[model samples]
Target: MMTVPSKLQSVNLNLWYGAFWALKGVSMAIRPQAITAIIGPSGCGKSTLLRCFNRMNDLTRSVRTDGQVLLDGQDIYASGYELTRLRKRVGMVFQRPNPFPLNVFDNVAYGPRVHGVRDRRTLERIVESSLKATALWEALQNRLDRPALALSAEQQQRLCISRLLAVEPEVLLMDEPCSALDPVATQHIEELMRELMQRYTIVIVTHNMQQAARISDETGFMLLGELVEFGTTKTIFTNPRDKRTEEYVTGRYG
Candidate 1:
């Protein structure tokens, strides 16, 4: 049998924020073109581990890390790796909808603009395709010049995703992308995530166990900054190997 290579990997990864250990020795292989969810109680390092994939944690002044975070078998933390390029390939969406205070077209076109694509036709095509991918083009096509912030909560989140897709990323790191939306909106975003996994490797950090179970192909359960268990969503929720994971999944304890 042929095995699918990991799109991203963490090997004995550790992280600290000003001497406070946030992520213990956590290691996992993220399969390509699948949704991998990290579920844990608050402050258990779910978001921290998700951020590590794109090196977003480096923005925090007090943060430091050790061990390897590999993208396509190459260590992303290597000295000569270009961070801008890494971020372009590994895009991230935050917990809240944070569309630039600009129009929809500008928000989706921002990344390509920064990457030095100044041609009007290229930017227009990228913006249209990205919005279409996120299912926003139909509703917002006539409103491309409208402010992104004026969109509904769900639209804003989808628009944020469109912005990431505009950059043509290979991996998408979502840190609770639906946390700010209502249940209906959350379901829409979840459906979008499911569709996106057909083309992108997605890792999501969600506090909602049900959401994790519903959308993830694989799930990782974390406790006290350590990955207590990692397995298929079915196994993790129904037959978790660790007592901690069982308790957490069953609402016995967090």
Candidate 2:
């Protein structure tokens, strides 16, 4: 029998910001074409760990890391790695909807254009396809000329996701993608994630355990920068192996 490889793998990974340790000896293997949710209380390293895959933490000063994070068998932290390429392959959606001030079409087209896709027809196709993938095409198709910032919070978030898809990413890192939206909007984004899992490896950091339980194929529990438990969503929610995990999931304490 053959085994499918992990789309992203973190091995004994540790991270720090300035003098403060953020993640401690955490390891995980994110399978391809699936949704993996990382859950924990506030101040835990869930967000820190998500950023490590695409090296988003490097934007901060005095950030340091130990051990390895591999993307498709290649070590991302290896010397002479190309950041642009890595980021292009592994895209990110932030906690807030941060669409550009440009029109809807332009916002989605920005990524491909940056990657040297200059042909007008190609840019149009990419924009259309990306918006369609995120289920924003129908509503925004007639409003392509309107400013992306003018849309509702949910629309803006979906637009941000469309923007990432234009770059043709293999892995998606979502940091509380629905934290700022209403319940209705959050459900829409969750449904979109389910659709996206057909073609992408998605890793999400969320504080909402219910959201994690509903949308994730697998779930990991973190506490104080340590990964206390990781397993199937059903197992983690229904029958977690660790006492800490049970405590968090069962509403005993977070």
Candidate 3:
């Protein structure tokens, strides 16, 4: 039988901000419907690599990169690539929850609305299904008309997830999604990630070792803009082949 490659893969990617390199030839595969965690200290290129998957660095005027990021076997950076379509298929969640000033219903419906889904019935269906998928439907069921910012911090983060879900993305990129959340809020997001993994490929950048250990199916460790190790999460956490990964995970040094 022929084995199919993963849905997302980075091949020998090198990124730089003008004269300074932020990631150097880092390569890894992200399986479909699985959570892949990128872990390391600050300025270690974990977040930088996450941004590469969706071409988020293009917004940075000084940024430049060489190599390929493949999505479903297609090179996203290739000439004639449709950035709008790419972004629609790959959604992003930032370290902090940033909802629009609109109400909860509008916030969750924004993506579909922008995509020309103007029918009230269809938008309602999308909003309900998306919020339900993120486990936020029960909490916000009665507050659909309330301002998104009126929710608690934890609710706000879940609302953020719901907002992303509304777009029906194929891959979800999370940059420390729980960093600004409390323990309870973080737990909610973790549970949401688990549910989300059944349908979306996920890549998360997290500094919290425990969070990575708990949620990731695969893990990659980076330092000084280079990938040092990539493997199953259990192996990366327990018996990493690279000394740098061992030290960073074991609390020896960041």
Clashing pairs in 2: none
Every model's TM-score:
0.98, 0.98, 0.97
Q: Write the per-residue lDDT of candidate 1 for residues 197-253, one digit (tens) a residue.
A: 999999999999999999999999998889999988999999989999999999987
Segments in model 2 whose C-alpha atoms lie over 4 Å from true places: none
State in Å the error of residue 94, model 3: 0.6
* TM-score preference between candidates 2 and 3, better one: 2
Q: Give all candidate RMSDs, comma-separated.
A: 1.0, 1.2, 1.4
Residue 227: error of model 1 in Å? 0.7
Model 3 global lDDT (CA atoms, 0 to 1): 0.92
Candidate 1, superposed: residue stretches over 4 Å from native: none
**How high is the CA lDDT of each candidate model?**
0.95, 0.94, 0.92
Root-mean-square deviation of candidate 2: 1.2
Task: For model 2, give the 10-residue run with minimal summed lDDT.
Answer: 1-10
lDDT of 2 by residue, 60-97 (tens): 88999999999999999999999999999999999999
